[model samples]
Target: MKTCKEKALEWGISDRSVNNMCKTGKIPGVMKEKGVWKIPDDASRPVDKRVTSGKYIKRELQEEIKPLPIGISDYVRAQSEYYYVDKTLLIKEFLDQKPLVSLFTRPRRFGKTLNMDMLRVFFEISEENTAKYFVDKKIWRCGAEYRAHQGKYPVIFLTFKDVKFDTWEATLDKIRGLLQEEYGRHRELLTSDRLVEYEKEYFLKILNGNAGEVELTASLERLSKMLCTYYNRAPIIIIDEYDTPIQEGYSKDFYEEIIGFMRNFFSGAFKDNKNLSYGFLTGILRIAQESIFSGLNNLTVNSVMDEEYDNYFGFTETEVQALLEYYKVSEKKKELREWYDGYLFGNEDIYNPWSVINYISRGCIPQAYWVNTGKNEILEDVLKIATDDITEKLYSLLQGEKVVARIDQNVVYRSIAEDPANIYSLLLVAGYLKTPKKELQMDGSYLCEVSIPNREIAAVYKTEILSHLLQIGAITRTTANKIAESLFANDHSKLQKAIGEYMDKSISFYDAGAEGFYHGLVLGLIALMDNQYKITSNRESGDGRYDISMFPREARYPGIIMELKWQKDMDIESLDVLADEALDQIDDRRYDADMKNDGMKDILKFGIAFSGKRVSVKTNR
Candidate 1:
């Protein structure tokens, strides 16, 4: 009997939050009011029994999960594990198995270190430990099975993530420092007969100025042997982002030295340490697998291509919905999906938690939010290697082909345009894109098209240059009005000419006569400007295709319709005939189908002609 607004208070949040939750596909609801709240006939959300751990939002803190005192760390901790995301559980499951070595390969910042830290907290035992900290979580509740195994193994975690090496010497110094720390921690086992062969050969050099490659390597071997001796079993070897140092290390002038030195250093500990436990090495690129890990035959590599635990990293649809409901930010779902919900990874329907969390926190889906946080080093790499064809295709994708196979994982540079999986991977990892859902292709391979995931990312490409309007410094209030005036002309040619000139100068010099380029340019122009900017789809006739389209995001600005021509083949009467032709399609193709639902009918005419690089614009009253 209650209205949507009245019922909203009972749900513990506002109407807007409920609506957004529905849109994000988080909490289910129906839109009863056009611009107001959705009246949820039933509010019970079904629990998701899928791969994600929590049915609701992911809570990061818990009281019983001990405040780990093992590291030189900061105290501004997150809510101590009230609920963990799927990635956390996956890592836990993997380590629970105690594999010899496991490597997690993801692009930068997919929570590699944080997940590593969770493993460090649970597995790595403290000497003066208490049984008090592990009680609240279910891991402890696994009862006698879990507790009996507690503190049973010595864990040695080496994090190369924070290590910065501008020079090979710096890298060597860091490695030596780590060795010294490890040796001091395991001094008792270092005295064992099995490991004693390394004290004179390895430690003597740390005391002296000269350390050989063999001695440095022998020290790691000695350490692994020591870990086995102390724990009475092999250690849990977890190496987080182990390959990052190599990637960053070589960008400097010392590539060969660092790689060669690192290869030898790691080969000792990783190349089958006799007294060793299993090990894990993670990094960005595989880094020539044969070159580093050498004979560590047990090493299992998990990159984006491997579908074993595809749902392990990114958020799933149910999780996304639950988070929206949890945060009460569900009112922004339609806005959220339009920008971010488009990437697909294998069979798992996942979303980027990083971007969505950021958007929901702000209460508005920003355009191109991911771009600001992403690394453009690959972008630089892409531009350098992009041939003319690749450049044109990127421009083509802008027009909405939902391109397949535009990227290849193996060929980082050349692969970006032909491999659909790799294209989304590059875009998602780079933060220039996101995974919205899982789409099963006819060919049996799933594909995720790159979309401007969230407003946090979409607002980047706006200019009269792209739409063909000349500007002074930036797109100001005056320029925006003038462009609106141009659109009001309803002359597709005028709008087309405007965009043609803009793209030729600002976008790319070689896109002349490229229909895909212009179509995308128009879409870019409409998407840019204030949300009120208008573009009427399929305006009018002889004007072909439906005439012109207008998008008015605000109430104050009048809509614009435009018709574009590749050449000047018509006189004024001919223009009218063409315009009439396009106007007819408006009704046939339902051009104004949705726009009319908003009640807007101010129409003008414009014809734009493009001749090579020349843009001739004309309008009719």
Candidate 2:
């Protein structure tokens, strides 16, 4: 007889699959001996007739491919059942540093929770020979010094990723429940003779969900101490998505309540806690001003801007290439890179793991997968408080241009509204923007040239970020559709009316006095046509720079150019003359030279003039 592992090796499948075959009686002579599957050495591998049918050959090909771990966060299951990327080297990195407390800040769905769970599985003491899980992993390939740390300590793991609630009472209740579950994980403490009576009582209070806010605030310190007493070793505490509740608190108007509770709660767990052997935390933002990690002299933060442990959070270039090769879709490399491969984590070029996996699972079709994972509250907030300068810069960004901004890694949520410049910092850490060039200032902040990461983010900017403008009634959908249709059809009259109507409704007198203001307004409106055109702005073509240009993605659409002019206190007659002069300038400067050079035969040029919410448009078709 052969064991499940042996059969898995012979069939080129996972042991879990062989074990499932035994459980389902797919094998002829399988027996359970000592709670382990015993299969005949001569038994043939079972095949699903439905999947193997010639009519379903395509489905069979899919079945032969290992399933992608779309949302699987469990370490053992992900590595064992799915095509797991070997992130076990993260274990090696952590062991080398051995900081007392480490906080990792990354965007959502970048495998933060899964990585934290992996750390827990690697370090937490288990009785079921957990070493087998890592025997074939990268960590085990390292020397004995690293392997010796496997399953060596008690671990207290908590994930506040789902602790979102509108009221403080409800959020606290959810937190208490999470704490109760973590305490229940260590039920052996109840019967340990090493634990004193008082410690056992406190453990029971947490286990039974009878612990109030006060007890829960100090729950981490107390539980770690009791766990140390029981195991005779200090415990590792891991908190995943620690900022979720804090972000919810800020958005739901319970900011003060959550911040106050977290200050004490985190302080008890990480700040100067003797019971903690090592602490690990993962969140989207650092939330430094809240004093959550204050006075933790040993704290080390690995943010998106840091070089240490950068490759572990997101998939590096080599990793994605291997994934593509494994799935037999290696030909999609260029498309995949163009859509999802522009994220910069520290100095490493990274791909969005969430989107890449989803793209592969969906037959390599590309779309904005990451944007739907959560609400874009940060972008919405930025749009809500955007000043005229900020608006113009955002328009420029959408046109595939970079903007210079200060990036402070210690940005807090409360300060976003206090100082709108913090929007750049928030956008960088949240994965919406990437910094290709950064120079460190004396203030410990980076002055970065930031732009949209990839085509996916550009699409997201048009759909998600611009949709906020519609939500706030900045421009009507009718106006947007009118502008898109008019531009596509080369109907200058309808385009003129659409721009006039949008300016009258959305632009204030103070906002229409500058060419930059009108430029931004027109850019936001024309952005609706992005699906059909590759929009660019302020590019040198022919003899000079044109204000805006739309290069058609397909030959069926016409290439477009617009030169905008604005003057203070202009009469209606003068505005008309200004519009005509703008059109004459586009021709005199030969702005159509770019599209012509690109083999475009049909091109349209428009000249738009704006003054105090009044607008005039003229086009040469």
Best by TM-score: 2
Q: Go through the candidates in order and give the clash count of each.
A: 98, 0
Worst 10 residues of 1 by lDDT: 67-76
- Per-candidate TM-scores read 0.60, 0.86
Model 1 residue 111 CA deviation (Å) reads 2.5
The deviation in Å at residue 437 for candidate 2 is: 2.2
Top candidate, metric lDDT: 2
Off by over 4 Å in 1: 1-88, 95-99, 130-133, 146-148, 163-194, 200-222, 246-266, 284-297, 305-307, 310-346, 355-371, 383-401, 406-425, 428-621
Q: Model 1 reaches what TM-score against the true structure?
A: 0.60
Judge candidate 1 against the unseen true structure and give its global Cα lDDT, from 0 to 1.
0.52
Q: How accurate locally is residue 82 in candidate 1, as Cα lDDT from 0 to 100?
A: 25
Please write out the lDDT profile of model 1 over residues 1-621, one tens digit for every residue: 233434433443344544455666665555546555454545553343556556333432131222212221211122231223434345446646766667776655445665665565556566755233343334555557666655566676777876667887777777667666655655555456655565545654653436655566566666666667656687766677776566556455666676787678777777767766566666656654336667767777666556655666656777777767665668877677766665444455556555666666566646454545534555444444444344444433443334343333333323445543344445544444444443556654445445444434434323212333333222334434545555565444554455434433433333355543344334445534444454433234332354355556555544555555553434545545554554443445554444556686654444444444444445433
